[model samples]
Target: MKANKASVEFAKKVSKGTPYKFTIDTLIVDHPLKKVTLSMGESFSYIPFRVEQVPRYNNWYHELLGRRFRNYTVFIESLGKEIHELIPNIYRGESVPLDLFRLSKPLKIKQPIVRNLSKASSYRGGLSNRNIALWHSHGWYYENTQDRWKWQRPRLFTTVEDIWSMGFVVPYITPMLENAGAYCFLPRERDTQKHEIIIDSEGSTKGSVYLEKGDGFKDEEGSGYAMKVPFLVEGENPFQMGKSRRMPVSKETFSTISFIPDIPEEGEYAVYISYKSHEDHVTDAHYTVHHSGGKTSFLVNQTMGGGTWIYLGTFRFNKGYDQAKAMIELANQSDETGQWVSADAVKLGGGMGNVIRG
Candidate 1:
């Protein structure tokens, strides 16, 4: 059994809604049966107001789901169980639905109070924290007794609230992730069409970073070449539908996005775009590569790794910000149905080898 590993880059300001980064140098698969080659082992963070819709809904198998899931809520006459319970006493008095908390039984000792559970260590076993007995991200997780794995440890400890509070910035919730398109994390990128990419601004640059969303999106499963379960490496990608990104369906030759980062740097950087291939949705991502001498465009079939980056190509540029402005598009051929157009992070750096470089 190979454990998936990552090198985390903690943010200097680890506050709520702040973005953190993780670079995954090794592509270790949970099971040998599954081949997970890392094109670029990297991840970032965000306080999820709403997650991408997990397309793997087994609606066909069980028509009677609401009865069993009565713990949830019901809306519009449709019976639905409350799978997640919001953590009380987090923020001020009012609350944000996006800051949903899935706890493992309320904490016995929260802020100000502390108790020595040294003898109680037998109950927690290997689960150790600041002795607060809490996981760092995603507030608290949801689990049941049926979980045969490491589903133990209902902590009685307490820790600082800042550690768990990821700046929860709510974005415009869409039905699908790709319908919103690729991005790095920008606190305010929650505009109707969320689009941007990694790293804090190093210096002043030229062009603005651009991101948008369009048509053509459908729900899918991760069994094939799609996002497999547990895509979340630390605080990123959880294989949840709300966690992925894609390009919208279009009647035009290409639905596009453009931007120039305020932060600037100069160097030769390779572009890595993440994508997933599923049985449904046919999409090909396109981008315009600009350099000192000339510029050209490249394309790749969006369906591939369950949510892994595929190298598109590289370019050379002078030391400046404007020169770093990037524009990537997902071609929406009039004849093509554009069922699946993946729009993920357009990372600029030295990633793994390019899967499809033109």
Candidate 2:
């Protein structure tokens, strides 16, 4: 007779809208012929929102969903019935005893994703002081000159991209996050293209910090790289405040721009960088981040996804004014020569405080 052992491992921090993936490994010593069937049942204090939104014909669809899921137990039982039908071998099991596992301390750092749970319940979780920037793609645009409403994007078989995002975010996601104790802000007031969303001022971004090239950057003497003056894109300006600095790609000189952030406290923060995307932009833009743990480097593709805040990774930093404590540097050097490298804004922390959007 042989014994079998198994282990499950996952990260402690979870992001909202992001899946929490875990791995389970098992070892059956000296029992190759033996078979094991694992039946797992997990439960949380609250029911998680469905990943996919229901196709709604009217307002009644959302109301029905809320009513049906009002009772967590009933909802789980109903879900279990569907699962049982799919797999006959699976059977409902008793709830796992809590004492069997050792619970850890509550999370000490700011979480990117805020879980939506019942506020009236005994749970002390709340976001009373939190500020959330609620952004959706787009919807319909009204041309005052034409005096008619038109779709911003092409209509799909299911729904329009902008309309779907606006519908899902406004009616559902926004309210849930608000109920959980967050103060939400809508960046997109109307579907007009003239309305621009800019977060340059300190008050707008809360405690987060942003750095631009001319403001908090300098290049090496005789770097041999031509710097492009700040300019706004006629159609879609990806740069922050409709401006950014770019340099010609060169193999001769590695001209770099350092972004030093003033850390308010010692904690982990999500770093974001924005750039103007163009066809001549380099495919690989080298970036190095110096944090509390160590230095990490990343090669970003500047050819695509410009004008948006791209997440680098979460890193721990010390509280201080010193650049050694926390800094990000980007070099105008890459393997590709004919392309150009951009330097725009670097953001520390989430739009509000040290938290990030999950």
In model 2, what are the clashing residue pairs, if there are any? 238-307
lDDT of 1: 0.35
lDDT by residue for model 2 (145-198), tens: 788878888888977777678777866887786667564555453122221112
| Model 2 spans with C-alpha error above 4 angstroms | 1-240, 351-358
Q: Cα lDDT of all candidates, in order?
A: 0.35, 0.49
lDDT of 2 at 308: 56
| TM-score of model number 2 | 0.36
**What's the CA RMSD of model 1 in angstroms?**
29.0
Task: Return model 2's CA RMSD, one decimal.
Answer: 20.7
Best by TM-score: 2
TM-score of each: 0.32, 0.36
**Can you write out model 1's per-residue Cα lDDT over 7-110, one digit (the tens) per residue?**
11111122224454424343333233432232222232122212221111122111222333323222110012211211232432332343335435544421
